[model samples]
Target: MTTSSSYPDIDAQADLMVYLVLSQLLMRHLTGRWLTVQHVVESTHLWLLTNGGSVDWLQRISLGSRAQELAEEVAQIEGITFDVRTLEAAFSGYQHLNHRSPAVAAIYGACVAFVVERRTAGSRTGSEK
Candidate 1:
């Protein structure tokens, strides 16, 4: 099992997992192995936590419309977060990393957004309570 020795922080692990999940989703989708998308997401989450990242580090991700709904519905079964949205917004953040593949850049951007949102929400809940 690979560890997060290179990325000791929760944020860093989350970021890496985001890229991993997204990239794997796209790659699997291209091969028509769509079912594995969810598996990849779940595996990535487990890998992160087991490798030294926090449980709260899992970021948001999405497939297509129906796929998104299925993910959300199944999430009720396990209380997981399966966010669905377009990659357009996330892709913009990685405009600087032209050398990387578009999918890779998009995942990186999305991870940053997800982590920021999670932190913001956590802060808000703390302030409210």
Candidate 2:
């Protein structure tokens, strides 16, 4: 289903986006094929450990069929241009500076940056400036 506005809904689905991107990244590191539960789990753990985030969040999550379903949906959202590798790099570096993994926050930040910049660029008046 399409969302109210691509921007806000993309923000809402940020978590799934990150996980999906992580899935792709992990796939590249692993077998370079389809993602499985093991791939998701390993990716999640690796991201947490290397990014210096607590592993406690894993307790509340399950990298099962449902996650794969959500990931597919989020990854297919129209008009969203995400470079999974670029996001991976940015997310990795962001953690070093902030002392925490950006996690879904990275997705939200990118959306915000895009919307703000787009609005400013397309504005007819200097009010947006």
Candidate 3:
């Protein structure tokens, strides 16, 4: 996955990349973790009450298996360096933010920010710059 020439199939690759990232986040939220379905819903309601964010629902989406497949695809594609742990942390912050949990967002935001800035900054400057 050299970051040299542009991938001709970027559109398809990007779609897969997005799914891979999103799925990892979902898995972290679900899968017998700290956040249960009830907790997730409660968090959503709390977030809505606190902030005017249009976060209506928080249902468990079935994408764990599929996300695993997408992750493999993303790995096969060149020039893509998104890590599942990074996505998981970003998603944690996003969910917490939706619930008006600034503290949680701050904690997770640091991890997400690091990965995002690292990837985008490379694009802004030359890869080796």
lDDT of 1 by residue, 20-89 (tens): 4443444443454453556556655545554444443323242221233332333333332233233222
Q: List per-prediction Cα lDDT, in the order shown.
A: 0.41, 0.44, 0.37
Q: After superposition, how far is residue 47 of candidate 3 from its true place, in Å?
A: 0.9
TM-scores of the models, in the order given: 0.40, 0.40, 0.25
User: Lowest summed-lDDT stretch of 10 residues in model 3?
Assistant: 55-64
Q: Model 2: per-residue lDDT, tens digit, 20-101? A: 4545543544554657667666656655555444323422142233445444444455554435544354354532222144
lDDT by residue for model 3 over 84-123, one digit each (tens)?
4444444434433221333223323332343345446656
Give me the runs in candidate 3 sitting further than 4 Å from their true place: 1-33, 55-108, 111-129
User: What lDDT is reached at residue 69 by model 3?
Assistant: 45
Alpha-carbon error at 26 in model 3, in Å?
19
Candidate 2 lDDT: 0.44
Superior candidate under lDDT, 1 versus 2:
2
